[model samples]
Target chain A: MIRFDRVSKRYPPGVDALSDISFEVAEREMVLVSGHSGAGKSTLLKLIAAVEKSTGGAVLVGGQNVSGLARAALPYLRRRIGMVFQDQKLLFDRNAFENVMLPLSITGFPRREAAQRVRAALDKVGLSSREKALPVMLSGGEQQRLAIARAVVGRPKLLLADEPTAHLDADTAADVARIFKEFNHVGVTVLIATYAGDLFPGARRLQLEHGKLLP
Target chain B: MTAWLAQHGDAVRLAMRRLASAPVNSLLYLLAIGVALALPAGGQMLLANALSLAGTTSAVPHISVFMAANADRGMAAEIESRLKKRGDIKRVQFLPREETLARMKANPGLRDVIEALAANPFPDAFVLAVADERPEAMERLAVELRQLPRVEHVQLDSAWVRRLDALLQLGRTAVLVLGVLLSAGLIAISFSIIRMQVLTHRTEIEVSGLLGATDGFIRRPFLYYGLLLGLGGGIVAWLLVGAAALWLRAPLGELVRLYDLTLVLQTPGTRDSALLLAFAAGLGWLGAIISLQQHLRKS
Candidate 1:
């Protein structure tokens, strides 16, 4: 449920992070945005998530213009879309369960239901036993899994992951990729940005070079 | 309404947890707020006592109209009749020179002193009890009596009472200014503490923001933190002022007994305690709102 009408993101000092990129990912479609470092994959996802506005053309998520969305409306837009940053962005002070429960809490889910859903999500990510362990206590793969649980706990329709498996070993990356595939299989629109498009088999690939979409 | 209560309850719980995370720091901040509030409160209490003492110790106000030495008996009679006609004078008692001398002679040691005088030195006087005890009204009556033909001097005996009232008024204003300054200081201290807490929880806050948390959601716990600190400080201040008042009660009672003055310290009552708590909570909430506006904008 995302469409970009020739979206372009330009930074100061004449730097173009993304230029004239247009694409669409239909509902429940699993896609991979393959790009090298600084190829504007993150910018594209950020534009869809409404984290960063498109400078030139319009970006639409859920049929609404992301560029024109009011500040008060950004939260609703973000609530519909789950985001995973490359750095994991897990709270080091809290245990794994709290990190996963954050999004549910933000949405004001009942505590009992929220705990149940958090447990289910953590279970899906194979983090059930480590629920009480802090992020510092988890391995890189487990932290990535924790982030995925947090992002998906709200059951966002669209999942935007930026280099989610960046620092993982091949097997762990495969495991993480499998988790994404599982969510996508359940009718969630998933667009993953990664250099290893080969990791996500049978998914539509949108390759980018210098922010321009390649056929 | 249920949901609103639940939300606030959750926020308060979280705030308590956050405050409990750093017990020592919270206690110190609370103590600072308490001491700041206590200073003005103590000042106000002492001033109240001073005012009450002034009220009791001052003599009953009266106006003394003294007739000139050369004035005749007819002039004295006419003056007394004129004073009795005025509505301002509720009662007028004439004291003849012979009676004034005889009363002085009755005093134990003053008998010899009065006999040494060749003649009665006391002049004919009228002691006028005025209708109003107000200082202004008494002063006005004294002014009117001075203009009487045979009246040599008019004494408004409430002059020292008026001066004490003025001094007490000045003290009340000083206490008010001190209270205002301390309130500002309390707010500033809470603001600083909230700012530090925001810094400490920066990542959690940012993550929550990213997860579509509303600004109100993000600000709720911090506001509660400020409010709790302020409230704790208020309680400490109340206890401190109460204890100090208790400690001073004995000493103050002894001092008043020595002076034969009917005055006692009026400790802060329920209304005062309630006001102190309300003020602390208000300042804490305000500080939290300010800090949240600043730091949340950055996030």
Candidate 2:
């Protein structure tokens, strides 16, 4: 469960990126955040991921108040909440399997179990055969799947995606949305932020404009 | 999952591989840090050996006090007694004018010159020895001895003593200043190496952080990199100092043999080596701290 209550994020000198927001994401549900450019989609995801704290109000993830967490422990908060970026952000120097294994390493899981889990995650993301390939070698859709595989490897209770399907073709985007839906059905809450015309209609849709959400 | 070490072992290994990706850069930093540490360490070993040689020579440090023309034996005796009673002093002896003239005359060509001196022109003198051959104590003794009423002159046999003392002090000051300067250099060395690694691996860091890696997890391998460089540099320094010490041993021994004195070069001992290891660890830790400040700031 994730909740943002009257959350307002402002940069220095008072430029409000997001203001007076209140929202709740239920457990095991998939939600699509539709927004145009500079609509605060990424900022909202960053707040849930604990990458950046909100300037005001509470951010609660999995019953833990994340807004008050110390910087050193912010990663622990993130560990429970997975994040996927538009840019895959894979270490170009490493292979796909290694890329997926990153989050497991963060929590200090040992090699054998981490390898096993990486394989399972890759299989789930339909990249089981591309484990040895680099991000550059993979197609756009493949790289996005690799990013999702890496995010879900930790078995996080929550997943936040910022434009997960932005660069993919229609069919590929639909496939990616299906993966999020499947993960949600298995009791993991998923949040996708995108301006893409395609929307997985069965999932909850939140349209945002200029940092405000329209009912 | 520190307890899940067996579970997440591969990812940790992968992290290490990720750092080792650029072998050329790592090697370059290792060599740079090693050379920086070696230079100062070699200088310290040279000074240590020199001091050891000066010490074991066991030469005496003494002061000579010449009495006034009208000074009587009683006043001279009083001054000697006074010096002897002080704990700061080890021994004091009064040499009469005749003994001094006789000793000088023991030379083959001094007979006529000594005979021309109708009476004993040289005054009675007190020759003093200190407990330890140090300048400050000897200087203080000289000061007190000169204050005596009957003494006309206080001449210290201090040429070699003062020279040795000055050299040792200069070495100490050098170590102090150089240690600080070298430590600062080490900081810069570690910072650059880490900064480069961070730059090359920025994508890796971002990906890991996005995937839920904490600041600590992100920092581990780089911290290890700092340690590796620091320890490597320290080992190189020790080897350099050790090799120089070995090279100088023969020539130093030969020189001392001509004077019939036996002294070994005082290389930094085991305790010193342990200190070097500790210093290496400290250098690595300090470097890691600096790098973490920058990385975590952005992450």
Candidate 3:
């Protein structure tokens, strides 16, 4: 669950990334934050994740004010929410399985259990066969799938994805969208930020333009 | 507990793998640390052996009490008896004027000079071995002996011992200063190595941080790397010092033989070796921590 109350973010030299944004998403709800490039979609996601602090107003996740959270406490908060970046952020040096295993490793999951969970997540993302292949060796779609597997492997309650289907084929994008839907169907709350709102039809859309949210 | 150990085990394995990836570079770094640490460690070993030799060669200090030239054998006997009765004096040997003259005449260089003298000019004397070898104690004993009747002078025969002790003390201090400076150099080397490693793995570190990795988790592998490097260097240093000691033993033995001293060149003992390794490892860990703090704070 996430709530933003009149949140505003300003970069140095007086550039506004997000302005007077107020929104709320209930638990187990999958919401699409539709925005053009530089429309504050990424900034909103970052605020919820506490990756960056809000310049003004309160940003709450799971009834906790993340805007005021201490830096030392950020890691614990992040562990509860999985993030899939636009760039994939998959370590190219490691194989697909190791990439997916990273989150479990961070949490110190038991080796046997972590391996099983990683395999299952890979299977869910249709990356089970390419688990041993490095990211550079994999196709673009497969890399995105590997990143998704890594994000979901830890079984985080809330999932945040930024442009998850960017630079992919139409069919591949549909497949990626289907995986997010499947996760939401299983009661995992998901927030996806994308310019291509058509990929996620029928989902509640919060559109943003020029750092301001549209009604 | 098992999970904690598993995490640490994973970190250590990762560190080892990273080190193995660059074997030549790692070996060169280890050699640098080894040579630096060996300098002071080897000096300390030699100094210790020298001190031990000095102690063994002069275990007891001696004092010479010379009787007046006019004093007779009866006065010499009385003074020797008095010295032998003292608890502080371990042993006293009386040298009569005739015996002294005859002993001096036996020396080739002194024989011609002694034969020129018409009469026995040497005085009766007593050589005393004292229990306390401290300079102050020896001086006090000499002053006491000089006050005896028929005694012309008392000489404390430990000036050379005191000089050797002072020189050895200076050597120890020099070694200590060298060790401290070299330790700083070792720490700087570790810091630079870790800094480069962190920069090389910058992307990986950022990804790890984003994936809910704690600072400790990110720092664990680098710390282990530093610790391993230091430990390996310590091993190399210990070997180098040991080998040097072995190589120098025969030469040192010949040199000491000239002075009638059975000095042995000794390698560092087990406890000292362990301490060196531990100290090196600690420095490596400290370097890693400092480097991580600088970069991790920026992230």
Q: For residues B1-299, could you state the per-residue lDDT of candidate 1 as single tens digits?
A: 55567678888988998888889988898899999999998897788678667767645788898999888889999999999999989999999988998899999799998899887888999888899999888887788789999789999888877787788889989999999999999888988899999999988888887889888888999999999999999999989998999889988888888878755667888888898889898998898888888877886
Which number leads on DockQ? 3
Candidate 2 chain B has its poorest 10 consecutive residues by lDDT at B6-15
Q: What is candidate 2's local distance difference test score? A: 0.80
lDDT tens digits by residue: candidate 3, A1-215: 89999999999999999999999999889899987898999999999999889999999999999999987788888999999998988887789999999989889999999999999999999988888999999999998999999999999999999999999999999999999999999999999999878998889999999999999
**Can you write out model 2's per-residue Cα lDDT over B1-299, one digit (the tens) per residue?**
45455433443464456446767866666677767776677667767766777777755878888999778888878877887888877777889887888898888798788889878778989887877667777787788878889889998787787788788899878887887788789988887777777887777777677666666667777776676678777887787778777877788888878888775665677877667766875796588779879865674
* Candidate 3 local Cα displacement, residue B138, angstroms: 1.7
Q: How would you order the candidates by DockQ, starting with the best?
A: 3, 1, 2
Candidate 1: segments with Cα more than 4 A from true spot: B55-60, B68-78, B93-124, B132-134
Comparing 2 with 3 on DockQ, the higher-scoring candidate is 3
Q: List candidate 2 stretches off by more than 4 Å.
A: A6-21, A35-38, A52-59, A63-70, A195-199, B1-20, B60-159, B249-268
Of the native A-B interface contacts, what share survives in model 1? 0.63
Question: For model 1 chain B, where is the 10-residue window of minimal lDDT?
Answer: B51-60
